[model samples]
Target: MVDFGEILTTVGDFGFFQKLIILALAFQNVLFPIFFCSFLFIQSDPERHCNTDWILQADSNLTTDEQLNLTLPREEDGTFSRCQMFVPVEWDIGAIREYGLNETTGCRDGWVYYDTLYDATIVTDFDLVCDRSNLAEVVKTIFMAGLLAGSFIFGPTAESYGRRRTTQLPVVLLLIFITVAGVSPNVYVYMVSQFIVGAALGGYRINSTVLEWIGVTKRSLASCMSQMFSSVGQCVMAGLVYAIRDWRRVQYVLAGWQAFIFLWTPESARWLLGQGRTEEANKLIRRVAAINKKKIPENLLDVTGEQEVQTHSGNLVAHLSKYMSFICVLVILRFSLNLGYFCLILNVGKLGLNIFLVQFLFGITEAPAHFLCVWVLELIGRKKSLISSLLAGSFFCLLTLAFPQGEFHVIRAVVITALVTTGKLFLNWGGSVCMVYIQELFPTSVRQTAVGFGSIAYRGAGLLSPLLNILAVYHWSIPIIVYSSLTLTSGALSFLLPETRRKELPDSTHESNTCNNCI
Candidate 1:
């Protein structure tokens, strides 16, 4: 009979070839976040402002429906319908100018050619202020809600099928959904497509598994590198958004890039070996050896032996029993962090600053933060790093709340901007640590389910962020205060988690040294 336990143990201890495969898998992690951040551009309401001038110049004698049909582009089906676009005459140029249109060069002069009934008067009377409560905002929220659902779904599936399959599958699906989302005939299609894309992209979790597969000496460096890719993704997303302002074109570009990832990426050898597919695993390992120009050990084939075959088993209930308590704390922290993060990013215009500048600065700041996290996580340990970040982020979130209502525009801008951006560093770092920790906690049998359940908490919070933003308008400081409190509490809960630095991962309940009641 095959000694399944022995094979699993050998495979669990990764070699140079396996490590390289894990690193390659990490690239998918980078791409997933880039696709995720691009969502901000897709959900943008700026297009509404672009058409403001045209809507105001429509014939005054025309009915509202007639005016809408005259101003908006014909639908893909060749129909003039209000349902085709989310923004209507309510966002016309006259309204935008009234609220304070900054630059007024695009829709001037010859662009306005109309008869007497549809006079081409320069509309300076309409309000420039965008309504926060609108279809655009609602669609954005729904898209994020899909991200929440996707995260949970992907985490478990990745664990069950193997990291490479779970990690790369989403990239393919994201490409398709993003393309569909971009070319969507109307806002309704756009909203649905964005949600599906969010779900597809949310399946990536290779960073955590990659960290676990490498040597302890390499863990911090590897973790840092993984985070750096996310920052790179952010910068890339910004550049892509700028290059392709048309939302659909942006989708097509991202989709095209994602499709390329499958060409170079490989499966996780550890996962394959765990399933007792040594020959297949060896083939993959040899491919890595070939690429890196290293010789594969002939003994590696014998290493699989006659052990390590075991049926993986886990469900939602089993997942909860393992880490429900810890997961709960993370959920609360994620919800608050996401609420604050999205609230600030989504409403950057409300802060009276250049939106593009704010986003660019935010992306630029992440480079240093990623490096800092690498340094801090190794020195203080994962629990301390997580707690300290949460506390710092909470403090800054609180400061933003205390600043006077209408004083020191520049100072408030600098202070609030610093607080939120710095807070993002902590959130991102802590989140990375959480991903690593969750994967380490469970055995391969239930790892996917555990990861999936934990992801639910993270995504669930994301779903609620848009609604929270709406509330922030009426009570600006409420979200800040709430998020700050949640961070502090999650930090305190960190004390309950066992520190797992430099420990060999446990293979079964017998070898497991889990902290009792730690969850």
Candidate 2:
């Protein structure tokens, strides 16, 4: 039987053709960070005070500071209350100033946000503060639900159809939905738009799986490259948000970028061959050969290998039952990584520092971490790398508990910020390593199915992460404790999985079963 890898070598592995595909796919990955991290700024609970400006009718000569002092109650910390204000009374300015009214009520007029960083965010625009603050987490949860739905839809669509069609369609949908989200008239409309945006983002995982066709030697490189591009996007988003301040404009910029990019992307020839489309696969191979200046025999793909593999690919349930242990561990690890990584990211505003600077640090640190992850993956192999990164990430997550919980101190805030950043970096590294590891561990016949199941777990954790972050209001240590526990458990269980470094990708259930025994 003529394997696709053999055909790839005959043409050229990691040649110009492969590099171009990687670049296109990696560019799409940038959207992951943009969408995921946008919440940090978009839902930011910025400094706010009650809208007590009705007093200005009587106190025309009062300064801004004087109006606030007269119309709002102060907390023990000496800051004006955000949700409460002194009841308005029709009295002269001098009389009210001397009498000092004490009755208070909810900010009936509304809030007056003092957000110097952003001119408008979902929180500010929608008034999702005080009693309405819980809505912010609900919006994130809806987006994650969309991600989960997309995983279920796109994963099988890629397997039944082709990877390129499934991937390309989402890019177009994402652009349209992002534009809708940008100009949303109200919170309800924005939530729906965000859901569609998340569904579109799910296509990126399918796009990434397309790169698995490259030879094993460059598979890690491809994975790391995609991750680095995502990190770069995070940095770009930080700069854009810093400059624009308006979340709507930021969404517009992201949508505009999508319109021009990804016009012409190539299909995965390996996937075409897997679907028994010999002529299409042959033509793509010849094109790659021509671009790489290599020649291939006419009978290069003359084999029934792919058809035989397809017979075993039909029943996802059968694969799940057959490889229960391997699939479950991958799913658990995905859940753990997603939960830990996003928990830290969503809490960026909680860190008592400049949110933009902290977010930029979060973005900038990822490139080096991914570089280090690739080196670690090459040095110790996939299984060990997963274990080490997860455990290290857990350690950092645990260290966040050391920060004082009562009040925000600059020194404590700085230390906790560093701890969370380091923790997030390690989890991000684990996620990058896990991306390649999933492609390598499963047989080609059931690989996408396995990834789909794992993605369900990943998005499930994403759905929970924001809700879990809300628990911080009760006790600051609650979310960190939960994150650390899950990460530690995943790291410990990673010992049971097999290593697949430098090994040929399995094409059948029998081969995958053999690989499963190698641990």
- The CA lDDT at 519 in model 1 is 54
Q: Tens digits of per-residue lDDT for model 2 on 1-519?
A: 777778888889889888888887788777677775446685456688988888889967789999998999999999888889999898988888899889999889878887457788888888888898878888889998888888888876776776778878888898899999989988999999899888778755655655555877778888888889888877887778878878888888889989878645777675665666767877888898998889988777666446544644467567657777787888899999989887887777778888788888888999888878777787889989999899999999898787667576888888888888888988989888778877888766567777777778888888889889888889878888998999999998898888878777766677677777654
lDDT of 1 by residue, 1-519 (tens): 322233323444345544555566556555654554434543332223223334545334556555444444454786532222323334554554355323223322112122211111111112111332266566667777777778767776765577666766666677778788656665667678878877775566432345434555446656666667766666676666665555456667777777776334466555665566778877765665565455644665664523434432224465356556666665565555555566655655455455456666666787778788767777777778777777777776677776755754887887777777777666666776776566555555555666676667666666776676677667777766766787778778777777766555443333442643565
The CA lDDT at 27 in model 1 is: 61
Please give the range of 10 consecutive residues that has the lowest summed lDDT in model 1: 116-125
Cα lDDT listed for each candidate: 0.58, 0.80
Error of 1 at 295 (Å): 6.8
Best by TM-score: 2
Lowest lDDT 10-residue stretch of candidate 2: 304-313
For model 2, state the Cα shift of residue 433 in Å.
Answer: 1.6
Local distance difference test, candidate 2: 0.80
Candidate 2 backbone clash number: 0
Tell me each candidate's TM-score: 0.74, 0.89
Candidate 2 segments exceeding 4 Å error: 42-81, 84-109, 304-314
How many residue pairs clash (N, CA or C atoms closer than 3 angstroms) in each of the candidate models, in the order given?
Answer: 20, 0
